[model samples]
Target chain A: MKFKTDRDAKLGYWLILPTVVAISTLIFYPVFYNLWLSMQEVNMNPIQPNTFVGLAHFIDILTDLDFWISFRTSLIFTITTVIGTTVLGLAVALLLNRDFPGRSVIRGVILLPYVTPVISAVFGWKYLFNPVFGQANYFLVDILHLFPQHINWIESPAFAIYAVIIFNIWRNFPFAFLMILAELQSISASLYEAAEVDGASAWQKFKHITLPELKFVLGALVILRTIWNFYKFSEVYLLSASVNVLPVYIYEKAFASYDFGQAAAISAILFIFVLGFIMFYVKKVLEW
Target chain B: MVGKNTILKNIIFVVLLIILLTFVLLPFVTMLSSSFKPDNEQNTFPPQIMPENPTMEHYKGVLNPDIFPFLIYFKNSLLVAFLSAGIGIVISIFGSYSFARLEYTGRAAIQRGVLLVYMFGGVLLVIPLFQLITKLGLFDTRTSLIVTYVVQTLPVSLYMLGNYFRTVPESIEEAAIIDGCSRLEVIYRIVIPLSAPAIVSVFIYAFMIAWNEYLFASVFINSSQLRTLPLGLNQLFYTQHYVWGRMMAASILTAIPVIILFLSIERFITGGLTFGGVKE
Candidate 1:
């Protein structure tokens, strides 16, 4: 029995070897390498070898006004999008939870935005907000007269963040809808029936029964969205480069400016912030 | 009086549904209609909801090799997505099985570590990954993209598969073992067949990640011939003259596969996403 048990353990190790190798090489190595690169002067010029710079890059990033501005932008973008998507998702889920004709079809339709490729969605949005002929401007300025002039929604710095936030909400709320809807399905109908017998109004029943049932899922959704939106790159970058979220900022530093070390330093800082959230997520959500 | 109240409520519900549906579908409708519009009419102010004279010129333009070579980008994307997701799934199956069924030293620690790595954002790793890829002489190559995508996708694949494997009845596999079947045979003959739904869902999830991935593809691939669909479409905007019709057509084409995949697997998506959160 001992021999058989020992053999089973050996086979297990062998089975997991490829995954371990892949994770170690691809994940663990890069994490430590990124840390090391953060502390060095990684000049692209071959003649100028990488030198130990020891916190200089971090100091530079800390002092850079642009970094702070982008950091603020990231915070605002993340908070608004997280709240917007969650609220919108919850509202839609509640509405759809009832038995309506073609509810299933509508449920599938709702997920289109979330599941579509980001590039496709961003391009579609860009066209809608096009300054020259976009329907968004026509509707808002020409038809509704909400604004005096047609705003350059994507190009102008003032409105680009809002445009991106709107796009993020539009794209992500379906995920929230899907998750909340699943949880809603699991809630016993008896609870709502009991609430009705107690003379609870629709709003009161929702407040007492529905809200409490969805609390944990909603909490997880908010945190997950926060983490995702913090590093959201493709949608914002595709929409407008000027928005300058952290991921876009990091991309500009590394690829555009070739300031690899500074990019790594900024990444390290971003990683620290994300690590705090991940720890909380693992403990509270994953319960590990 | 009650009939009137219910009728009013139903009216309200229909109106809200219309508003929601319009919000969701308008962009797509715009993209689709614009794609069919003639080039001259595409930029008309107060953009027409319905095209005056719809034409296939833009689709022809996209298909024209000299203009975009979109077919190559499409092929590259398909190859990379399939290869990466396929490789990731195969490796994850064994790893998840070990985590699911085996009593091994450090198993719990490794699982937690994977979860942490899974949560670690991709942007943070780009610089080092770039450096590493360049050093390995794999930059600007499909292999680099595939390897990176596999790594990016592995954790979630493992998590989903591991959770799934645990749910599968262990007695069946043990019975096979008692019948003198090797563990490998048991896994191949029993475990995989039983977990088809989960395996399919995981594959679709990984494939979607690979297919829709833009960040790494944007950074790592530089040569035009090597560009994926997203990177290729992005370059269209920078060309000397931007063609709205062509651009819209390209966007629609890029989205079709993903839309098909999603519709086909609609049932699994909600289950897969909430599986982790609601597990407890």
Candidate 2:
């Protein structure tokens, strides 16, 4: 018995080796390599090696006005979108948790925006908010007459963040909904039954029972959403150029300005900041 | 009075359901409606919700080889998605089974490492990865995308699959082991058969990740012939004289299959999804 168990342990190591190697090389190594590249002036030519700059890139990033603006923009975007998705998801999860005809089908359809490609979803958003001929302005100006005229809501810097936030919430709420619904299902029916026996109303049950049960999942959801939203790229980038977030800023620095070193430094800084946040959040909030 | 109150409550539920459906589905409706509109009507002021005269001209244009090369991009996407997801699934199956079933030295440590792995994001890796790819002379090739993509979903795949694999009765594997079956044989012959649905679901999720991937595809794949769908569609959007109708047509075609595949596996997906932090 002992010998067989030993063999099993050996087999386990062999089976697990590939993933260990892949994550270390593919994910962790790039992160470290990025940190190294950050301190050097990246040379694009084949002949010359990158020269060490010793925190020059970091100094530049600290002083650059646009970097501060993008950083502030990302924080606001993350906070608004995370709150939007969590609230909408909680509302929908509570509403839809009840059994109904065609419930399964509705649940599946609700996931479409999240599952659909970012490129596809954003294209829909752009067309809906298009400046010249868009359904959004058509409804707001031509039909409802809320605004005096058509507005370039997604394109203009003034309103693009709102549009992006709304878009983010629309796509991401499904993930939160799915997770929260699962947790809701697992809450014993006996608890609800006991509440009702005490003459608890719907609002009372939600406030006293449901909210407490949902606390953990909601916290995890918010943290996960914040992390994902902070570094969000494709949807925001593809939708509007004017709504500058850090990822878009990094892309421009690396590709547009051909400043690979600065871009690398910014990415490293962003990762460290977010990593620090995750540590504090996981330790203090989740208490795991 | 009781009956009247019940009726009012039911009406509110039905009305709210309808409103929620409309909000959730307006994008799909617009995508479908615009794709059918003729090019001239696509940009019309106070744009028609339903096309006045629907046509197949946009779809036909998308499929035409001379114009978009959409088919080539589609094929490239399919190939990369299948190849990477296939490889990722195979590695994840073994790794997840080990983590879930077998007790090994250092198992707890690696599990925590996998959790920390969730903190790393694409923007952090893009420059270094681009440098690594260029150094390897794999630029403009699918290999660059495939290798990175395989590992990109590893932690999620592990979390999701490990959760599912834990439910399979260990006694069966023990019995197989006693009957002189190797661990590898037991995994294939018994464990895999039981977890097929979950395996397939995780696979499709990873496939969608690769298919919808745009950042690396945009940077690494410079040759038009090698462009994946996201990059290609984006290029089409920027191409001078862009037609809204044709672009919407491409978007519709790009999204529908993935959504349908996801719907089919919705049950397995939501179950596993609760634990794994989402990729997006």
Candidate 3:
């Protein structure tokens, strides 16, 4: 039996070997390699030549005001969008959690923003918000009489962030709604029935029962959503080319300027910053 | 008093649902409406909620060679998404089962290891992997995208399958073993048959990830022929600055497959997420 147990353990190690190799090769190695690059001076200009300057790239990115601006934009973008999405998602989930006519259809519709390609959705949104002949400006000016002509949604910093926020909220809420709705479903009818039997009001029951049941899921969602929203790039990049965010800034730094050194520096900054966020959430909220 | 409260609740619920629905539908509705508008009417001074002169010119423009072979990009995206998701499902089935039920010595440790990988966002690894993929001479090809995509998606799918596998009664596998079934036969004949729902859910989740993937696709693929829908649409927007109607048409065209898939698997998508979230 001891010999057989030892052999079984060997078989288990063999079975698990491929997964470890694949993850290490594909994931861990890249991260370590990027860490190496982040420490080097591999700027875009050919005349400058690549140099091994430890922490120089990091120092440069730290001092750059644009990087700080992009960082601020990312923070505002992430916090605002995640909060809005979660709150709206919860409200929608509560509204449609119960049976109604065409509930499934409504649920399906809610997922459209999430399911739709970010590029396509942004394009459509740009058309709608077109300042000149754009439908958004047209509606505001012609119908609502709120504006005179059109508003440049993408060019202006404020509207650019707002548009991106709207897009992000629209895209993500469906996911939150789905998760919360599932949690809502798991809440037994008996709890609500008992509350009603005790003459508890709807709000009172929600506060006592539903809210408590939802806490963990909601907490997890907020953490996960915040992490993802912090790193989100596609919608903002596709929607507003001029309005810079951290990821776009990274892209531009690397590809546009060919400043691989600075790009690596920014990438490292993003990773560390977001990792700090992950640690904070894990400690405080996820308790991982 | 209860009746009045119920009525008020219903009213508030209806109002909330309508507002959420509008938020959800506004982009799609706008896209659909704008797609039919004539080029001149597309970006008019006052946004026309309803197109006065609806034309199919934008759709025609999308089809023309001047803009791009939008259809080809569509096909490329669909192909990549479906193929990657299919490949992912197959890989995870074997890998996940091995992790879950293969009685490996370091199974718990390996599972934790994989979960840690999943928690680290893919963006962190992009630069180095870009170097690796480029060095391998696989850049700008669907094959490269499909292979690397597996790395990011496999962990989540494995986690989902692992959880599902745990729920599956071990007694059944024991019964199969007693019936003179080989390990492979037991997995195929028993496990696969029972885990179709979980498998479908994994497939859909993978499909969503592949379908919505943008960053790598944008970075790696350069050729027009190989470009996925996301990258192709990015080009369309950047290149054709003023072609609002046609851009909207292309947007609608691009979104179709994902929209369809989500609706079809709405139940599984919700269920899978809840199961994975709570159990994890």
Q: Global lDDT of each model?
A: 0.87, 0.88, 0.77
Scanning candidate 2 chain A in windows of ten residues, the lowest lDDT window is A1-10
lDDT of 2 by residue, B1-280 (tens): 6798889987888898898888788888888899999878888886778899999998999999888788998999999999999999999999998898877889989889877777877888889988888988988999999998999988888988898888898888888888999889989999999999889988998899999999989888999899999999888888862788888899999998898888788776777353355666
iRMS values in order, in angstroms?
2.7, 1.8, 3.4
* Cα RMSD for predicted model 2: 1.7
Ranking by lDDT: 2, 1, 3
- Per-prediction TM-score, please? 0.96, 0.96, 0.91
* Candidate 2 C-alpha error for residue A127, in Å: 0.6
* Tens digit per residue, CA lDDT, model 2, A101-132: 99989988898889999999989989988878
lDDT of 3 by residue, A188-276 (tens): 99999999999999899989999999998789788788777766777777888766878888887777777776787788889888888
| All-Cα superposition RMSD per candidate | 2.5, 1.7, 3.2
lDDT of 3 by residue, B1-280 (tens): 6798789988888787677677678778888988998866665554556889889888887877765678788788788888988877877787777777776456777788887774556566666677777767877889878877777787888888878887888888877877888666877998888998889877877877777778889878999899888887777666744477778888887777777766676676667352454211
Candidate with maximal DockQ: 2
* Predicted structure 1: clash tally: 0
Estimate the lDDT of model 3.
Answer: 0.77
| Candidate achieving the largest TM-score | 2
**Candidate 3 residue-wise lDDT at A99:** 80
Docking class of 2: medium
DockQ, structure candidate 3: 0.53
